[model samples]
Target: MRSWGKSVDTMSSSSRSSQKENVSASRFGPKLCGYCNEFLSNLDLNFDQLNICGWVHSMDYHDIHKSARSGCQLCIVLRHDNTDPEDEHWHKAALGAYYKGRASIMMFLKSTSTTCYSAMYGQLSETISYPGTSRRQRVLDELDSIGAYHDLNYTPPKSTESQTAWELCDAWIKNCIKNHSRCKILHSASWYPTRLLYIGHFPTGYLDRDLSSFNVQLHLTQDKPPKGGYMTLSHSWGFIAFEMLKLTSETYEYRIKNGFSYIELPKTFQDAVRLSRFLRSDYIWIDSLCIIQGSEDDWIHESKAMVDVYRHSKCNIAATAAQGPTEGCFYPRDPTIVSPLEISLRLGGEEENPIPKKYLIVSDHSWHRSIEEAPLNKRAWVFQERILAPRQIHCAKDQLFWECNQTTACETFPFIFESHIEYSKGAAPLALNITSLDLTLSEMRKLRFCETRHDPFPGNFISYPQESSYSTYSNISRFDRTLAHLEGATIDEKIERLRRNIFLDWNNIISRYSSLELTYKTDRLVAIFGVASRVQEALKDMDIYVAGLWRSQLPWMLLWQIRISDTPPSYDCGPSWSWASFNRDVYFYAIPQPHDRVLINVDEAHDGHTVAKQGAASSHRISYLKLRCLLYKIEPDIAANSGKQSRTRFTTPTNPRLGFRPKSLHTDCTETDDYWHQAYIILVIGQHEENRLWGLLVRLCEEEPDCYRRTGMCWIDTEAEPNITEHVRGATDKDKA
Candidate 1:
């Protein structure tokens, strides 16, 4: 990204001129004496003016004509006043001329000044020709003459001796330790060859060789032949030493009192020491160096700590990579295959000029198995003696195979809902509800049903819950009841009953529906009805019900089914009584009967007077039915409030019955005249509240004609006499008629 600004081209010409002039007069430019400057000013200078005169003549001319730029010689006599005080412009002009290819002019200017080479180079590069090689060489030589080369290459190599393989490996190990301080080290047989060759099986030829002889171990069995040519004698020696170091470091620390010892040999030991000096270690405990290898007692005693040495080391550098194919090394070969006679003869010391070979045996069976199977075989064989016991290898492999099979089976299993449902039914009811009962049941039945008709196991399976709730009622009681009830009932009747029942229950228990107050122990059961109740209450409150039940820790309600009307009706104007429009005027049938009940009468205009007429005129009866329907709708709220035991006393509203007195009434009527109407309203409200108190009670008794509970009842009304009277007085008698 470029800097946030316009380019320098946006600057005015005056600003550019000022910048040029400032640059010219700065000390960074070529230094010039007043005489030289005067000479330049007097000359009818062209770009090549400096080249026209000889150096000596130019100098002489500059001294005489230095102040001749002014017209009068007498003006030059007034030394200070005659000289141009604002010489920046002239300096800039000189720079401009140099930049315009006046190399000789810049050279002339530099020759007349006492500036250093660097300053001359700077001015030339900025205003004239750039500094050439000769100038740079002079600067470097000057610095060298003063002796500053010591800081250039501070550290130097000690010697030119070539590093042996063992030395290189040891150094690499130390470097690894310094870099990674927290990695565990492990090793195998190749890491302890010296001890193994001495105590374990080895060819007589190898054993009888002179102690100083470096011979690589070789394998005769045929498989893939080792990759490289014969190993060198010197490299074999390095391998032995490397192995010895690993064994000694890993095994000797715990046995000896001083915990330090050295391997001693005549010429061989001396060469090993010299070669080992090239190696480095941050903290190594090589077994040969750490234990008195020559002493059998010490070796036997110290060998016990070998496990800790390898296990605790930052890293182990095994000589596993040291040997190459064709080298006579102890490379493990497959036992099932036999080597050719010629190859065996070559590997053995049969030939007149036998070549030495070193082969890295990956394992005893390198080519018999696939790449995927190789690791298991190697892990089993390599660590058999030190880490794994002979008997455990088979068991370990079996376990590994079993686990892999199990994983594949799980992934490939097919989903069957019937089988799942069957399985769920077989399980304990509590457990079923607490888990994926629906899914389990569905899958059980699906598997069974599918299996009877076709294959039980499909190619693959993905299963989810069949329904939100499947184990809420033990033995599927609720589902059975619902099915039975819907057998002969109309959809509208079922819906209306369900609505009334839910509203009454919820209204009765509304006060007790707080999340903080209710405690839900299990997810299954609570996810069903608990969720439903909260949703119903939230809807009634005239608040947008954003489902946050999951966000809350306590279970509130479970969603069953949400019904969205085709034409979205206003909340208060909905056909059914909603919680918000509970007391609003509306008419509905109580039980679909001709003359079932008259709950409320709001048409009577007499003050404190009301009439409850059963099977009256259709208009009057409908009007009365509307009031009763509205009252019945409000019952759910009352019932909902009553459900909560903690606040059961306050379940019903304080004013259960509402009475209105119109001002157009001729005379006030006694409470006795409207006793039935008032009593009925009170009775209905109280019964609704009671039903809400216990859903089961409402379910059982609500069907009775006089099922109202009278204990919890109260009344409230506003005085509308003034408004009624004014409306009546304003209207002409004919209008009333």
Candidate 2:
């Protein structure tokens, strides 16, 4: 028989079972009975609604000799007499063997007798109607002929203990490397790091090799830096000595002279080095090993280069499965769990000839769950690492996951969803349409499309710009289109726009990052400094980038509110005016205000002590900030004050007190302490509530004399019995607004 195959692109998304209809009709029309041959000759196949299997298209109904039981490939294969249809073991084993080339499903079907195919066909008709079976069958029938379907009989050569993940990952990476348009990397020296560690050799099995064997530093000569790409390791240290493998004064020279032996490093690091070498890369950059851990100066310099290290690396090896440094990346995986199930159909009871077994690699959705909920994803540092890396291969516990700028894929669902495209249900005219757009915007719009937001404060809430139900959809769609439109324009300009937009959307990023775990609260700014630095580089103008706050975007930013927490942080790490001062959870919800209300007046000038002014250029490692702003002294309402809680109320020489909450009070005032008499507040922004007013509250930063930090947020509904007219009159500074 002549071989038959076609490119995957030729087939429709739902063309799995239907492809065979065309192929079989063209090849076997002469062998079928007259009626079957006539039906096959003029068959108008509906690509939209194909049969579950090709039997409907390949069978001869008139002649018993060429009946579906004997003539159809699918019917003949689905009736196995040697194995039980319900036995998963044989099913999985057969599927594994076929994938391993030890067995062939196509060959088996041709060789099997279809005399008893009717009984198996009936059983399949019953079970295949089940939703799970139907879904799996669709996925399997969809696989291209060239794809690997795992089998039980496959084994590695003696030189290799088992299959290495690197070979698979290398193949994937090499394929991606060829797509020049999508594979370009920024090689600018500023962010593109030069120095790296060269792990000893390649093609070496990691099973029993001594870690010490891979120890060599590849110091790139200034004239000739290695042309090929390098790999980076992003894993959690898990209470291990992160400061141990550093370039300190005492160890710097010795370490430079004597390269870092993999055996001395943690298991996670060792695995990373091995994987990098296997990926055909000459260099690997492990954070703890590359950076000077104990040296402050070296850390200050190298820490700023974090963006370059991750963004420029060819691939980031994430030890997603490992909880700590001690846990290695690779773990034993059961073939049964990894392999898809192969099911066979049985026909004609106990009296007839046996049929061939049909093979399928079942789709497992659990892989997505494992990847998303991986322990590594929970870390604050790893969050940035995962998002920044251009391409990353997650060494997960259940299965390996691949993520890039384009899409996220796992072994089970190889092509679940494209990153930049949208997919829909069913066949045309409602079929899937793939369009390029910002994935983030596309997702956010989906949420908005289905969500219904009700007016929370209907009575006397601010007269803010009321958003229609479809407003979010329109806004996000416009943003998405704008991004897509800038693709071929000046790259630098596009990057600058992306950077600025990222900063504009900083609220969402900060809200999530602040709640994550961090060993040192002071490192909050340093940890995200890489992200900030990248954004800064894209900016056409120089603006003050304070600890974790941007001076250019203080109005909306200053309204950040704290979420509930056990222990509120102190304000020593950063100025009280920034969220960086608070280590607890925070979020940004729009504070209702009039459409025309001006939040702050940047052009207006007041005395140095009274006007809002930015401090000097923020040093990457600095803690303090200097800002001058209008401050108002206020007294707390003792009855409404909640000790240490984010909720409270304060009165400004006015009858209607302003209700608010602060992450934490900084006056060293106990519940019984009369700090309310000395405490001061600033109105971040005022809202028009039924023509009345309300505002976001900020506590005075005493250290800076005039600057203030966000404590809590509030809305004053003056139309209610407890009026806020006096508070508004006292707090509103029209000139400042």
Candidate 3:
């Protein structure tokens, strides 16, 4: 059955072709050889030779312009002579070839009919056909009828510009490679060859999974921990492929086998140098020296490796004692420390040294001042500023032999002497316990100061006077006030002096709190003082005055609230009747009441007390009334309670229940002619506060009615007498019945 259907379709197609050929003959007259511009002249000529020759000519001279009107006549005649009627099989084959060519032409000429004839003649046969043509012409005519002819050779000019997808891809790849090559890479030991390159602000975690696919590791460092900063890798180009993969995963390991440890710096000068040398060793990495600080790109790249540097290092040697025991002790290193003998000899001879060497003599009393007052070389006695004082001996030792003249009790020489004195008070010491002249001076000062300032009172109290040592103490004593009174002090000097005293006091308080070690209490005190100082500074110009009250007493008020709340301090009690009362008196009276306009619209629905008690009320219920009050510059206090003693309330209703409700006997007011005549209803509703209803009522009153009247009552003069007898008779009859 399929074969039969195919045979029938073939027959129908052949019949349609025959009909199209007859139509072409009627329309174009005859077929002409495209190569010669002449009629075929013989239907029996060989078609294969002619078609092949035409195709070859079209391929060779397709773009060439000829001076003659059409192709060579001899070429067309030779093509016709090659055709023969005896070769019926060849003619049939030629027909099949033409049908195949027509199919291609139809496909190319689908958009325009003119292109079909042009393409067919230009390629197949270079001859002009008559208006009504042959078999080839019939095919062209049929294609034109179907609007399936278009010039395949026609192309639009290259005026429009657009990038192909592949071009964009190539450009992106090139940029990525360039970026990767220029960037630095950091590697992890665990990941080995898997490296990460620092890409600007690209997240490390995002690159982790991405780089992992390409066998690369992404490392990131956080200022605190867990996340932040940039990504790092081992090779510059590794990030390109890593980014291309678009990996997003955890880049850090939260749990590890080892715990955190601290690196301790050596105490001795020789040992400190040795430690510094060890840090500079090939295997060791010191960020300051190893990372290139001047290069922004280098810093950006190395910043991501900070986590690895700290985490993988033997230990981090935190230099807490870098700042010594004096103001500006953090001065840059120039005059280096040497042996104590060298420094002492350099100050002329020990005996010839004229400059007063000030030693800070800290004792239980005012020993420093007593030592200063001693009849020793006045020039040799100097007092060092004690801010950032060293807590350990090494730092003091480091400064002792330096060119600077400052000295402290913790230095090696001073330490040995003090230790000997301490032991001598209790037990016998070795020959090494012999104290130096300087040591003797320090001890004598300690003794004299103790005698005067450390006179134990009945309660073991000692009164230290201002004439004592110049050691800057935390306590604001008569000594500090006296110092402030000194003449010729500049603004910087005053500020510095004030800062010194304030810092001392602050440090002392911190020390006291530390001894107690109550974290919450310490934090509270710190926060209170810090916040108070901030507030004072911020409100320097404002008239607001903040009393220096103890935070412990007033637990309800926070420093932030005091600075930010709109209402004044008195109303700060948390939502109580007293707070409401305070708010009413203070805030309500802060702005003066307006009295020019007489008429008032009462939005009873939104009245605070009413809304709080009754849940249904719309926000816009009082809107119109509010507008009227605002127009007149009236002080429209919404929800005003009628009675004198009623509490001023402010509460919002829940969302579920809202809008107006029906009027009842419970409603506060009834229609009255006297007041109604003078007053206006800004709005009217079933409920008193409905602005829409009241607005309509007000409009009607303004336009239509000359005077207001009650629905069922008449206004009578106040002095009129009542008909008492008639009212009494009516009451009596009702009682008898």
Q: What is the C-alpha lDDT of each candidate?
A: 0.23, 0.46, 0.21
- Tell me the lDDT of model 3 at 375: 20
| Model 2 TM-score (2 dp) | 0.59
Tell me model 3's lDDT, rounded to 2 decimals: 0.21
Which structure among the candidates has the greatest lDDT? 2
Question: What is the TM-score ranking, best to worst?
Answer: 2, 3, 1
- Which candidate wins on TM-score? 2
Better of 1 and 2 by TM-score: 2
Q: Each candidate's TM vs. the true structure?
A: 0.15, 0.59, 0.15
Candidate 1: how large is its RMSD? 40.2
| Residue-wise C-alpha lDDT for candidate 1, range 1-737, written one tens digit per residue | 11111111334545433332231221212223333333223221232332332221112222222323322221122112112423322221111112112211222222223321100111221121111211344233322422221121111112112222222223333333332221112111222212211111223112222334432122221332322211101111232443333223334444322321222232322223322323321123333444465554554444433433333332322212122111221223221111100001112122432542221101111111221132222221122111111001011111110011001000001000011122122322221221221122222322232222322111112121122232233333222234355557654434333332332223222211221111212111121222332333333322222111211100011111112223322212111112111111111111111111222222221110001111111212111011111221122234534565332121123333322221111111122342233222221211121121101011112434533322112222113323322332243324311
The TM-score between candidate 3 and the true structure equals 0.15
Span of ten consecutive residues with least summed lDDT in model 3: 337-346
Q: After superposition, how far is residue 668 of candidate 1 from its true place, in Å?
A: 99
Higher lDDT: candidate 1 or 2? 2
Model 1: residues >4 Å from true position, as ranges? 1-171, 181-275, 281-300, 312-737
